[model samples]
Target: MDINYLLIHHDELLTYLREHDYAETYVNRYKTTIKQITDNASNHNWTTYEDVYQWYVDQSYSPTYLHEVRAIIGKLEQFHLHGNFPDNKKSYSSFWKIKSAYTKLSSEYKQLYEDFETQTCKGLKSSTVASYRTKISSFLYELQCKGATSLSDVTEKDVLTCFFADGVRKRSGSLCANIIRFFKILSESGNEEATRILAYIPNLRIARKNIDYLTDGEAAKIRQVLEDSNYSLSCKDRAVGRLLLHTGLRGIDIACMQLEFIDWNNDRIRIVQQKTSQPLEIPLLPVVGNAIYDYCINERPMSASPYLFLDSRAPHNNLTTDGIGYSVKKIMSAANIRQEKGRRKGTHIFRHHLAIKLLSNGVPQPVITRTMGHTAPESLSSYLHADMKHLRECALSVEDFPMAKEVFQSCLK
Candidate 1:
């Protein structure tokens, strides 16, 4: 499509859309107006819906363009009155209206998101509140673009179709996930019917196995590689590898660790997990302790963030839980430890490795559950699979011959 469609003189287009008598109701047409304006430009050869969609995500566009976008929003207000706020209220389209419904989130929906913001991650830094709010705004704009004037007008399936099959806008699974969660929260919070409507969404990236950890041998190899190449691997990476393998803590738990939490005298680590809000006191295993000590002494950035992990790039910045996986990946690549193709070398692998190591060592299931800070024992399946290598190693470690011969020799003696 024509890239110029994105080059729409939003200022000129908005001045034109403002003239329509039904401008308030037509605020939904901003996307179209923007497209049409681009179409009318000099040497307008061609364009695709994708180009227009990309324009929405582009922040480099002038603020004047944003103001023009705001002017187009006026039509959605007008369109909503005619379509949704009627005397009868039965004309539901059931079409996929992401931006429209998200833009005007009901109090129930907002409350669910707010709960996620406050109860899930305090100070709003860790919460998805920022992205969710952005999603809401994007949803409204999308609804306006789609001419989605009423929530009742769209069906759940219609939303799915628009999200997946719509050639106009190619939404990633992550975006769809956010949209789905918004509706799910709305559904859970007294709008019981909203749940039914959202049931149709394929529920993107719902990690079936919550704790995916690495195998003991695999973890051991990673550690040795890091230790050998002391110059290439950071102290934090080495410590992370060791702790992840030994303690099986999640990235969130690791990021939350501080010097005060380490009770060297008692040899325990006290952490308040975000998911369960449960205070977990895990004993400091020797391997984990060694790694921590080495990292702290050799690599910890001298900064105010007190976080166990720090970004070397931004020496003063705290290590975000978001970057934990990437950090693991970088170190893994540096170590030339691609034991498997297309498989990510991530922090979670350590947690799974611990589970496998425990189960294979004849450690009790209850103990394993508690050791890894798992809320339920049932969460061990993914770890079970990921630990296949550990199991094989355990099987191979046993010397199983001549037991009967030894018993016979003892009897003869």
Candidate 2:
């Protein structure tokens, strides 16, 4: 459809959105985006939606804003061609196209995945189910490539080759775990073939990588920058930074955090974690509490989103994990952290710093685990590698194998 046509019927589109239960705020935001894109199209003498879309992509909007623009523009094109666009929430499963391997699979192999998904995923969260579906589809595809036609046709060598294939070892633990779960479910349903295949899945040793975290000096710089009032940070930015620094909340958890999660009267913040679906309650440190209040009272947009943090513009939807990561980068830039090339600068670094700080202060691993809302106690072991204070205590004396004084002098030089 042409830009002129969209511009002419933009009002009709907005009305249609409202009729489809889109929030009024979202409708209004769509109207604004439509006008903006159309105006740009007119100035550039661009007639088609594709022309406007290409132009929009070249602009310097933030990642979050760009996503909103892309979604609105795509919806407009869909509405102009058809009478309506697909409801995103209802189209979740179709969003991830099943791999070609599954497409080529004989009916028997395909049934294995379908049965596992339909029967085994009954009580699992949608995200977990989606993950399992992807893993199983990929594994089954590998089995097909290895010349297996059916479950009964598979051998231990086929299973081992699939498990140890290139780029699979890093996640061998999770991939194997999910695959095993699928087989166990099938076995319980009396698939004897599945029980035999289960015996072929090998246990994998997960290799832990060194974690990068903010040093005390770098963390102090972040604190100073946030408090300086010289960086012109939005209250929401400050609030998110403080939450990550003080509360050690995951970016996804922070993104999904709701207004009601806070207990102002008791100075505690409660949440059901997104990763593990477990409940966690943490103290609302005064720094975090004040920033949140400032954002909500003074800076937050006028919207009815139950989420605590939101997009600044109309519709004001909950902030995404990407949005939270962007905020962390912004705060780190203001503090002059991680500007060096190849340095890691994700929000999880703050999480790691918090855990290591807790460990350095002599907090028990169980206490730290609960505070971090880790799904398993072993999850905290990675941070132990970053806890330099206690690690030093475990160091052995070098007196027994001391080098010559001349060698030490040469090393020092």
lDDT of each: 0.60, 0.81
TM-score of 1: 0.53
Q: Which regions in candidate 2 have their CA more than 4 angstroms from the true location?
A: 1-11, 14-73, 77-105, 114-123, 145-147, 155-157, 160-173, 184-192, 195-205, 400-413
Pick out the ten consecutive residues of candidate 2 with the lowest summed lDDT. Answer: 88-97
Write model 1 residue lDDT over 1-413, tens digit each, in one string: 43432454444444444552224444345556655545654443324333333354364757776555543433322233332221111232222133434446555445555664454345444344566677655653554456544454456656666666645445666777777766666666666555766776665554453443444555666777666865477678777766666677888888777778889898999998765677798989887788789877888767676676666642235566766776677667765676477565767666666677777777888888887777888876666665555667757432555366678679899
Residue lDDT tens for model 2, 129-179: 777767788888778878888998899988887766574553467677888
lDDT of 1 at 380: 69
What TM-scores do the predictions have?
0.53, 0.75
Error of 1 at 295 (Å): 3.3
Clashes of 1: 28
- Lowest summed lDDT across 10 adjacent residues in model 1 is found at 83-92
Clashes of each: 28, 0
